[model samples]
Target: MKRTNCKIAFNDKLLMLFAIPLLSFIIPIVFFGCRLNRQPYFNVARFFSTFIIIVLLWMVNRYILIWCRKRYPRFSDVRKRLLIQISTMLLVTLLGNNLLHYILTETIFTENPVSVFDTDHLITSNAAAMFCLIMIIGIYESIYFMHELRSSVQETENLKRENLAAQLNALRTQVNPHFLFNNLNTLISLIPENPDHAVDFVQQLSKVYRHILEVKDEKSIPLKDELDVLHAYTFLMKTRFDKNLEVNVDVPAEKLQKRIVPLSLQILMENAIKHNIVSSDKPLQINVFTDNGSLVVSNNLQMKKQVNESTGIGLNNIRNRYKMLSDAPVKVTESETNFTVSIPLIEQ
Candidate 1:
């Protein structure tokens, strides 16, 4: 990266040297109708001497600014870095003007020393040169900043898309046959003892799967739609834990129209159960409520001593999905006795 930046800086210097001098010569000949067309040698020598000095000043200013930016990056330390930049530019402009004035008076236009060194002539020439040179540097920096901004925006968008795809893949894994197999075994056990409840279980299971499939293309869904999906998921969990797992949702009717990342509640609930001991002796109680335009999911912590290994994909998926869907974060609060997550309820 350092080597590439050095190469770019070298190319920019070359481009400025060639382009600025060529334009300087052409503008007078084409637009101003200066007799530079008749006295090509004098005109060429004058412009060439002046541009050579300006280019040197530009190269020095560029190097100094690059060093300042590296030491105090604009994004991290904007005020200090900009102060250093302006000071450096002024110093370079002063030195460059003095150098140009000396060259014109001593060598290039020696026949007119009085005009070159006269107070008014010196002030006008120095001011014009400083303004033009600084403008060149300013334009270059502006273009570079614009390019960087565009690249940063594009990279952020790409990362958002990639994370969204990862969330989808994780959701797909959750809905795959391995997950179905466990529930299938539970259903098999229930069918022989309670045939009617097994039918209801199968129906809810189908609804849960359908909801997952339907939300694949959606970034956010109404809270009520998510609640319906959560109800279907709760039915499946109830089959396994029965009285050991209790879930209560207490959201008001007015908040139902608010939006959230789909399946976020289900993911949080599952995360709570996966890490907790759910048994008749120590039941896991999960509560879903709304507070200050936020959906809060809290569960009593009864951490299991032994359980199946956890992959932690669900919570991460929910967090990543929330990041893409809204600027508000999925806030988590944990303690020795409870784990809570608050998701910002987006207005539809």
Candidate 2:
């Protein structure tokens, strides 16, 4: 609803300097046949009149173009902007031509006046007006289309950079000393209690880091691949929380090939554990599955009585990443008993 500066990326001043006079000279000959063997070799009066009309039309249409661009600056509004610009220009061209003829014939030439109603004059004049209108509009539209295309590409790149930053921040949080110490304690305890599982735990921990490094630069990954990595990350969390945190993944085999944003499930898993109560007394349950054409993550709402405030960086990161890949939204639904997040899946 706000407005941007009314500027087109094109500079038409020099263009108009050459184009207006050229159109002025050519329109008369193109629409109404010219005779070379006339008294005054060239009709300076007619040329001057046509030149004035062409200049008037050009100025009006140019202003309309700038106004429309300012009013609807977004790429999404291009259709509406073009519709308004062209319709308004066409009306102005027709009316302005008629008005200019009226001024020249009725106001200036009294005795030997031109017939403004002559069918030949009407047809030629209207045809010439349309020719100039289309030529000018075509030039403006072509430049605008290219500018918008470039702008869209730049915006997408900016989003990608921000998404990458968010991912890096999440990565830092994971490898922070606190996380390493907790996992180290778990591994130490496991070595004496169950040496085989300790070996499995170390392997899973490596898999989690390896998965993160693999997908850190990826856009979308197959659901099967994501789930494999997700299980690895969950294994590490399960080692820390034991039976207090439970994650169930239930995607059909056929749907495993469908794709999603990289590391989405793990972020949701972490989010569930962070805000909710995950203890022996009140275990947290997080479910991952496919619904319709989307991947869903839902967790029961056994919230902590006093927890650090949520910044929503995790969910927002996935959302921004998804926007670059698809128009489908990352949906979040919250109820008294549970919280749900649904991410649309992409075809392989």
Q: TM-scores across all candidates?
A: 0.61, 0.68
Residues 71-117 of candidate 1: C-alpha lDDT, one tens digit per residue: 87535576787788778888777877687668766876665354544
Per-prediction count of colliding residue pairs?
Answer: 0, 0
Per-residue lDDT of model 2, residues 250-318, tens digit only = 999999989888888888888898889999999999999999999999999987878765544588788
Predict model 2's lDDT versus the native.
Answer: 0.85
Provide the overall lDDT of each model, using Cα atoms, as 2-decimal numbers: 0.75, 0.85
Off by over 4 Å in 2: 5-118, 305-313
Predicted structure 1, TM vs. truth: 0.61
What candidate 1 gets wrong by more than 4 Å, as runs, is 1-167, 306-312
lDDT score, candidate 1, position 89: 80
